[model samples]
Target: MNGRFDLNSLPMCGAKTRHGIPCKRKGNKKNGRCKLHGGHATGAKTELGQLASRANAQKDFPDWFFGKPVKTEYVIRALSSYEKLVELMLADEIDWDTVFDVVEQDQIPLEMLKYYIMFNVTPEALIIIQSALDTYYQETHAPHLAFHVYAPMIVFHKFFRQLSAPDREYLANWFKKYSSRHPGYNW
Candidate 1:
């Protein structure tokens, strides 16, 4: 006999059923199982089986499967609402005083407030908000609140490019004064 085993020379799986009938099909070269009983055998092909397959796939990625809102999704929704407010303000539907009132009341969240000041406020609107912040700071004697209000200027400094020269100078002077008052403050 030749030393090499050819495909034809490979043995059948010869696996028996409960009734003891031979499998009769050709076996795999590796595992020696018939194609029907091989590990590569396909799952069920029925509609119900397909649905179960899809469900199993979804189970592997439950977040996408359940359509849950992620952290960025909530931020996007908040920015959308903020954009709507800015639109109304620009259209003269809502006045600066109302926006200032919202900030004074602490109705706006700190994160959204930072975005609002950086992206949406005009020089004129900024003056009003700054004045309100000054008043709040004086009344409460809370330098931290002032820091919180201006922290966005440092964080979103790129937005400073949109400011007029006078506005930029004013903000620089403000920061200088704030720093002098709170020498230990890093911001």
Candidate 2:
């Protein structure tokens, strides 16, 4: 038998042109298209091209581009929990000592505090929470605790903006003082 393969037996591109003629380009082995005829045309090379590609991609998969909306029930539940905690604090039911103990013992997560800030709880409630956290920091001498409590205030500036001007300045000064205690520690 002959060792040579016949080129005429290979498949060609089925793409048509404006004149209703078949594309003369050789088809890819797998996809049946030449490179110039979209055999392996990956989108975009430059940064601008990438941006345009992303924009087009968003149109195809919009939900992936824009995150899912938050459920109203979840928001209500979070707000209610925050309100109850604040009420308990204001009513003198939960003192600083209890708060400190619960936090130090890991019964309550530090992330809960971050969430309170994220939810923009009442300014009065925030002041109370901050004061309790400051007391805990002083008594426990935990730099991490102080950082965790204050870092959110600075990082989420929108939450800080909700505070009065004087409150904002106070927090800024407090952060400066805390950060200075550990030289070279900047957050």
Candidate 3:
């Protein structure tokens, strides 16, 4: 024999091989890979190389590997419905039960409410929503980490409850004013 091959004495590739066994070759100093396992290869530089690299990556991917597949047309329609629902929600501000259902069963994440539930509202409505948001922020004292400093649905319920009957009635009727402007939405 040329020499003794002491496994522990040498640095190993350590990367799994096609047969699911560890490669015995010495690891590259840079990335701990053997030459055949991309140790000698640098990343894609050219546009064509990048495209080829992406294609190679996706070629062996399993079904639904990147999470659920979204239908483009369905997504468009669903967004339209959600926007319409938000408009409708602006109408029934008094019914906290309905509000709870909308937030809970509707499965709309709080992230969705940041803009659509804020600036899209009327100035008078803004005062109401903004006041509730401020109160929620103050009460919770949660870290102002997310885009929405206030997102608790319960806070809105309490705020709406405290509103005068006239304001509630106005919100309950607000949709009627804009419903005609936005037709064809089933929401």
Residues 1-187 of candidate 3 have per-residue lDDT tens digits of 7697654654788788899999888865567667888444688875335545655675433222223333344334434434544554567554545434433332323323333344444335444433334444455573433422222221233244455676556654655654666787553
Clashing pairs in 3: none
Model 3 gets an lDDT of 0.46
Best by TM-score: 2
lDDT by residue for model 2 (64-135), tens: 212344334434543554454465567746666665664454312333343444447555655655555566
Order of all candidates by lDDT, from best down to worst? 2, 1, 3
lDDT of 3 at 172: 49
Kindly indicate the candidate among 1 and 2 with the higher TM-score.
2
The lDDT values for all models are: 0.51, 0.52, 0.46
Q: Count the backbone clashes (under 3 Å) in each candidate.
A: 0, 1, 0
Model 1 score (lDDT): 0.51
Better candidate by lDDT, 1 or 2: 2
The true-versus-predicted C-alpha distance at residue 177 of model 3, in Å, is 50
Writing each residue's lDDT as its tens digit, candidate 1 over 89-176 gives 5664556565555444442232334444545654354444445455545655754342322112223455535556765676677778
